[model samples]
Target chain A: RAEAKLIDGKAIAADVREEVRVGVAQMKEKIGKVPGLAVVLVGERKDSQTYVNAKKKACAEAGIDSFGTDLPGDATEEEVLKVVADYNADPNVHGILVQLPMPDHIDEERVLGAISYEKDVDGFHPLNTGRLAQRGREPLFVPCTPRGCIELLERSGIEIAGKEAVVVGRSNVVGIPAAMLLQRRDATVTIVHSRTPNSEEIVRRADIVIAACGRMEMVKGSWLKPGAAVIDVGINAKDDPSKKLGYRLVGDADFESCKEVAGAITPVPGGVGPMTIAILLKNTMEGAMRAYGMM
Target chain B: RAEAKLIDGKAIAADVREEVRVGVAQMKEKIGKVPGLAVVLVGERKDSQTYVNAKKKACAEAGIDSFGTDLPGDATEEEVLKVVADYNADPNVHGILVQLPMPDHIDEERVLGAISYEKDVDGFHPLNTGRLAQRGREPLFVPCTPRGCIELLERSGIEIAGKEAVVVGRSNVVGIPAAMLLQRRDATVTIVHSRTPNSEEIVRRADIVIAACGRMEMVKGSWLKPGAAVIDVGINAKDDPSKKLGYRLVGDADFESCKEVAGAITPVPGGVGPMTIAILLKNTMEGAMRAYGMM
Candidate 1:
């Protein structure tokens, strides 16, 4: 088999961000206001903050207005709900997202579900979920992570139709919708999760493997088809004694061996990671357009 | 390997119907109205009418009120939408199902989307689909065939959690949601469709194989994991010269050979067939209860 090309997710995501920047600028001029996204963070979890900062930075580069509400770790559920409720009714706030895994005391479901479906930029709203599952209807916002994965593939010129695609996870946020989106694109998809006894062997036969299992090194090179494209969605924190921070991020798949066998592959840190923020910005702009009936 | 047990879907569905019958009677007395399902047939297609008749018959035996609207073949999209709108507004109608493969003239997407998500008893509503896809939030109604497949397995005392389940086919109405439902029950799930080249080999490793490919005898006994439970959801009309209807219905798997290798297997016509309508009634009752806040 011929060697596979390395898929540059970072470059693709950068291009997407540039496109979003243009779209937002056009919409702002036509509509007399820029698309606005409001993100609420309940606590100062370092990772969540980094994600939020990246999202805000992306929004800025895309010419979309971004707002953030950071509450103390001890904030009550009602405190977060109040912020969400305020955004839900704001005409200027076209999209709203409450960063996940809030403090233990806050009821995450109540707060997340509180966001109106139309402004659910995070795509966690049941309404958006419904939209993804319904055959012909388009989701107001496909969840960013899954959407990013597909965007990476499409932007990379991978043909999904009639391909054997295996997704190694069943996460509602990523795996489930990723499978749905891939299947919608005509890929014959197989979703193998924790319950799968011989997941490695199963994945080895796929033409395309999407490893979003979140377990570091769960998918190795031997588990992939010789020329298969690999998209690793996991961003796991692994202990690295040599690092100044004492840890580093690694994907679910072992990249070293996988790159040797995979025909095309998305590297961790620089791969699917960047595309997620890009898609979030895109979804926000799309949400604004959809709300204005331009969709 | 030891001989497999053949699961009798006919008897299982019959048992389910009886349970629904009891529930329907109780619901009627408690709510002052029997659960009602309105099936809209947009044309004179014979196959559709047969399905409509079957559903109506099941509703009657279960003591649920049923209504049908059979429009002409040339009916406009608005005309069909009118029926759906009427059913949506009718307090008496607890569930609404528009027969599939509507005539060419009607815009099926617009018409299907027109049905109020609340009365979408077939669970085709995007909202319901989304609800079903979410982790903890259950749908108001799960689509019949998928729900039926799971119910059949559960009632027969089969263990779903921690089992390896392979679903053949990935249709929106059946394969996709069936896998999701199985995952909800803690089954490790994999979906294989037409594009799956090594489907038979994959099937042989599964503890539970759900065949919904709609192809007669495509899966053979060799594909079975010895002692695995098989759920055949395919209802294909094949050339059976001996049958009076000019053909006989068979499942995706070769039942005769499958029964020899499978621990339990449901036959084509008798297996998942009866369970489909049974689950429809169950969904309607559940929908009624949800709407009435009884659940």
Candidate 2:
């Protein structure tokens, strides 16, 4: 049986962070300025807090300035909007990210829409998203997760242009934008969602498969074409009695089985997870350079 | 030979126009206001003039107000922007359309972007385009041609959801947006462009096919899946000495051959062409309703 080459997203993401660190240092040297990112957290979800902490730590390590606004879970939508507006007007803040899954009272779309597109590091702003979708138009920023997925593919030397690529989700965050990016790179891209009747057959024909449907082990070895490159963006938790936490993280692809068929594949924990913050730092640095008229 | 049922876009477009005309009349009777569409033409291209004239005629027949701004071929970019800005501010103008392919000197994007998204009946604004692409998000308006394609499909009782839809082109105006619209309707969508090496195989797998590649007879009858619904959006001129004009219009699909295999197909000149202006008028009426707080 042929074993698949591991697409080490952790290592690639580290390299990207190092590049951003260097870029940040050089920008500081050239203009006495460092990129600033403002993270707005509106709730107290444990998962959200952990993700926010990781992002803040990553920013510090990259020599980027980090700004935070912590609002009570019950805060008013106006309060969230005020904070976002302040960041939009702040000269030091090159990027603004409103943490997702905000309190129920907060209208996520309205808050995200309020962010200045130039500082919309998360790329949730529709203007950035629209530009990204259009041919010959350049977006100020792309959402981090999908950008990370593309980085993983390109760094692993996977060819995209003229290839058959299928994205197994239609999420605005990952699947949709990832398909857009792949199509922009000249790949014939298909998006199969929950409603798709022949998704497995479609997956079997792809040279590249992006599994972001958030289903546990949805993509199996039998679903892939031999030698296909698989980038699994799904990170679902499966219960495991043997594990200390009583659970194990698994990607949408059934790793144990898919490895035998895929030419290369990314593991769940060590894959797309680390790449998000790394790309955020990169987007922040780029935003700073644009703000300073240096790039 | 079993000939495919003609989709009859001409009749369907006429129905849409009639709907818009009634809506406009109702609004006028109820609120003493009719929808207004502003056509901004920057160059003296004959084709553009003809299109502008047709739009104006359509507006008059529908009892909608039409406004025009004509500039020379050498019009400055600033001059065009100013015209768009004026229309954006005019309360009477519910929709603004900048005739495309402006002179080489003008920045088309800047002019298009200047139109307020609220009045962007043409749906070329990046905001509208982006909203159309994002899941769970709605655009103020959809582009005319792509919207017309979907209308043709639905009006013909063709089921879209859960179907395999292959859009053969990646143009921002037609192909990209059409794919977005199809996916929105729950179809598993694939977009194949010039760079797609296996375009025919992909097309052969589709339950529905949208041919907007602008290549004359590029999609052969052999390339289609039997019973696939085909909507041809391409209009190309083929030299025909038999025609009075020395040329005849054709679509990307070879109509004579495709009719044998397709379940239903739209003809070249009588097809998607009439649908564009019809959709534009419909969009203008909707924009007016939105402005007047009617819808």
Candidate 3:
């Protein structure tokens, strides 16, 4: 048995935040302005609220300006769109992000699409997503989680070019975009989901695996091609009364067992989670930089 | 060995073309004007000219007006973009497609992006492509070959939902779009490309397979999972001095051997090729119908 390397997402995210902090300072000094991000939160789902709060806090730490608006749970899509329109028109706001899982009454796509594409920092905009998948075309913003995964891989000193990579899920936000990113990097990529009859067999042959299917512990240790690098993007809450909250967060992979066979692995909570926030801030800063033609 | 059923793409395409013809006629009778498709050909390549002619002829058969112009091979990108802008403004034009493989002097994306998203019949525009990958959003047009692949499967009564489908390639035009389409149909899909280590092994487990890698005879019969349905989209020119043309067309799959083991398969010359033009006409008609609020 051999020891596996832990891909410390928190440490890598710290590196990114530091870079953004310095970059933000330089932009402010040279251009007399700092990057600014605006988030519109509709409905107060506890989880979504917590995520939004973290984003605002990250903006502060990275020397970027943050502005946000909170709408009631019963807010109409029109109301949300109105708030987004204001942010979209604000020249000071370099990036506009409407928090996801808005109340069911809201048409999420219409609201998201209404945000001017230039200010779509979340990278959920269709044009950006499609451009990211294209060869030779640059997307304005790469979705945060997928961007975070690539950051982890590159910062870990692992070679991505010409490697065999498998993405377990095909969600537009993560899995699909992640596969596109991998392909752009010259990795031969594959995607598998619930319908896949031989997911385990397909995964066991990967040089690198990205698990974003949101199924808790679905990928078992036995599925790992020994020494495969695994990046788990799933965040599922499993009931564990041992903690005061009566639940604990787990990823798509069976962490403890899979780590034994994986050459490198990221932990559930501290891995992909922090990297996402870091990338969001990075996108916001980059968007500002591009707007100023400084980069 | 028992003989395998041939997936007669030509027949399936004929069915689609007929449907479009009826749909177009109804539109003309009800609205007093037929849908129109405009093809902008910038070069004099014999193959590109032939393809353009085929598309115009299909448009005529389907009762859709065909518009085009043959520009010199040395046409500037600005010149091509100006032409696209004119078509974009013309109310009569419903679908605008720029013939691909434009002279090296012209930038494809610049010209394609110039077309109004509403009139982008090629579906190569970033917004349409991005929308296709999106879950709830329906794209105005899907890239023809990928759309044709789905049509072939649906017309033949092969179920896609909850099936294992493997797409061999990840090109933006065919491979990537095909994978997304299959996913939308509830097929668990995997994509394998040049960098894939075990493309054959991964593909062999599929209930359906789409080979769009453009490599001649890359898929072998030895790689088939018995009874798998195969769609061959590759169009490669292999040297064959036996003919006046000096080369013959072949697909990514080694058809003879694969068909022997597969439950059903499409032939190289007659399969996906005919379906592409058929889908293009279908898209043009549908786009016009949507514009008139008829569909």
User: What's the DockQ of model 2?
Assistant: 0.93
Considering only N, C-alpha and C atoms within 3 Å, which residue pairs clash in candidate 1? A4-A263, A130-B130, B5-B263, B7-B265
lDDT of 1 by residue, A1-295 (tens): 5556878888999898898889888887897778899999988899899988988888888889998899999998888888999999898899999988898898776776789988998888876787786556677778889989998888788888878889998888999889889977878677788877778877986888899988998898888888889999999988999999999888999998898899899888899998888888888888888888777
DockQ of each: 0.48, 0.93, 0.59
lDDT of each: 0.85, 0.94, 0.89
Please state the Cα-based DockQ of model 1 relative to the true two-chain complex.
Answer: 0.48
- C-alpha positional error of residue B172 in candidate 1 after TM-score superposition, expressed in Å: 1.9
**DockQ-sorted candidate list, best first:** 2, 3, 1
Residues B1-295, model 2: lDDT tens digits: 5789999989999999999999998998999999999999987899999999999999999999999999998889998898889888899999999999888788777788889999999899988988999998899999999999999999999999999999999998999999999999999999999999989999999999999998998998999999999999989999999999999999999998999999999999999999999999999999999999999
- Chain B vs. true chain B: TM-score per candidate: 0.95, 0.99, 0.97
lDDT of 2 by residue, A15-49 (tens): 99999999999999999999999999987999999
Which sequence of candidate numbers ranks them by TM-score, best first?
Answer: 2, 3, 1
Name the better of 1 and 2 by DockQ.
2
Shift of residue B70 alpha carbon in model 1, Å: 5.0
Candidate 2: Cα lDDT at A130: 90
lDDT of 1 by residue, B161-234 (tens): 88888999877899878988998887877778777667888898788899988888888998887889999998
